[model samples]
Target: SQKIEQNSEALNIQEGKTATLTCNYTNYSPAYLQWYRQDPGRGPVFLLLIRENEKEKRKERLKVTFDTTLKQSLFHITASQPADSATYLCALDMGSGYSTLTFGKGTMLLVSP
Candidate 1:
């Protein structure tokens, strides 16, 4: 069986600080991993995708590091702001194409003034 878990609590922090979130998994061999940002009542928007062979990936303000050996991934948002507050989701690509994604519920991020 495969399982993924993210922090269920909302991370509250002041603006202009880096926010770090964790994703943990067990017993899954995923072909690819993705991170997405989702606002309330909206669909998730893809942020970064890292393959099994790759170690780390980055986009403008976001950085993601994947460690297959540890069965974990770390997501970082630098200089987070109130506007950056949202839920972040981590998904595993199962590679079958039919039911390809298994997503962790998400971790809510709250950046305060």
Candidate 2:
């Protein structure tokens, strides 16, 4: 069976530091990986996407790395602030010929000043 997983616990960080999040999976090979940010009681907002062939990608203060061999992705936020606090999710596109995404449970981030 295919499985995607993120940290089940909340991560706490001080303001102005970098926060790193991990996403792991097993039993699946995806064409691309996406990371999203979800606020309370709202839908997720897309942050970054990395193709299986790409080793690393970056936008603004955000960065993502995908390792197809390990079936894992790492998400990073530099100069993180309290406003950056949110639940981050990782989704896998299984190339099922549909526009559907399989997501992990999400990992919450709490940035304190």
Candidate 3:
């Protein structure tokens, strides 16, 4: 009964701007949350991971915030560029130290010059 969804459309934007993405879910009790960046026809690269007890996590220009009460997560990319254009994914931990990641369809980001 758990579900995760992300924007299916490509986000078109100019270079040097911040891009925001969303991940929404329901009926999942996750011990931790993870975000990944994927390029066309390739495996997703792990971005950030936040535990249930944590409020926020960051890596360089990327920031992620998790809200368990709302069952949602937010991903942010500051000073995004054309090279940053890629699909971002979110995963929820299913527990047992062996967690299963259910990825969203992903949202493509397009950064123009």
Candidate 4:
């Protein structure tokens, strides 16, 4: 069985600073790593995805890195704002299809002015 872990504590940062979130896994080799943002009492919204063969991927002010060798993934948000505050989740897609997925409980991020 595979397990995913993300920091259970809230991460606080200044509005202008970059926020970094970590996701580590054990006992599984996934083809893709996906990041999502979830508001309290709501479903997660998709953020970014990185393939196992890729070192990093980015979109706008967001970036994601997948290091298969380390069994870890890093999610980054540059120029973070209060609106960016949310719980971020990391999910594993075992095959290329992304249909088979396992998710972590997620970490909370709070950006303050």
Give the winner by lDDT: 2
How much is the lDDT of residue 70 in candidate 1? 94
Q: Write one digit per residue (lDDT tens) for candidate 3, span 1-113.
A: 67898877889888899888888888965888889999988989999998888888889999998888998888989998899998888888877677777777788888888
Which window of 10 residues has the lowest lDDT sum in candidate 2? Answer: 93-102
Inter-residue clash pairs, candidate 2: none
Per-residue lDDT of candidate 4, residues 1-113 (tens digit): 88999988999999999999999999866988899999989988999878888999999999998888899999999999999999999999998563677999999999999
Q: Which residue ranges in model 3 land beyond 4 Å of their true spot?
A: none
In order, the Cα lDDT scores of the candidates are 0.90, 0.93, 0.86, 0.92
Residue 20 in candidate 2, Cα distance off native in Å: 0.4
Model 2 lDDT, residue 67, Cα: 90
Question: If both were scored by lDDT, which would come out higher, candidate 1 or candidate 2?
Answer: 2
| Sort by lDDT, top down from the best | 2, 4, 1, 3
Q: What's the lDDT of the predicted structure labeled candidate 4? A: 0.92
Residue ranges of candidate 2 with Cα displaced over 4 Å: none
- Relative to the true structure, candidate 1 reaches a TM of 0.93
Between candidates 1 and 3, the one scoring higher on TM-score is 1
RMSD per prediction, one decimal?
1.3, 0.9, 1.1, 1.1
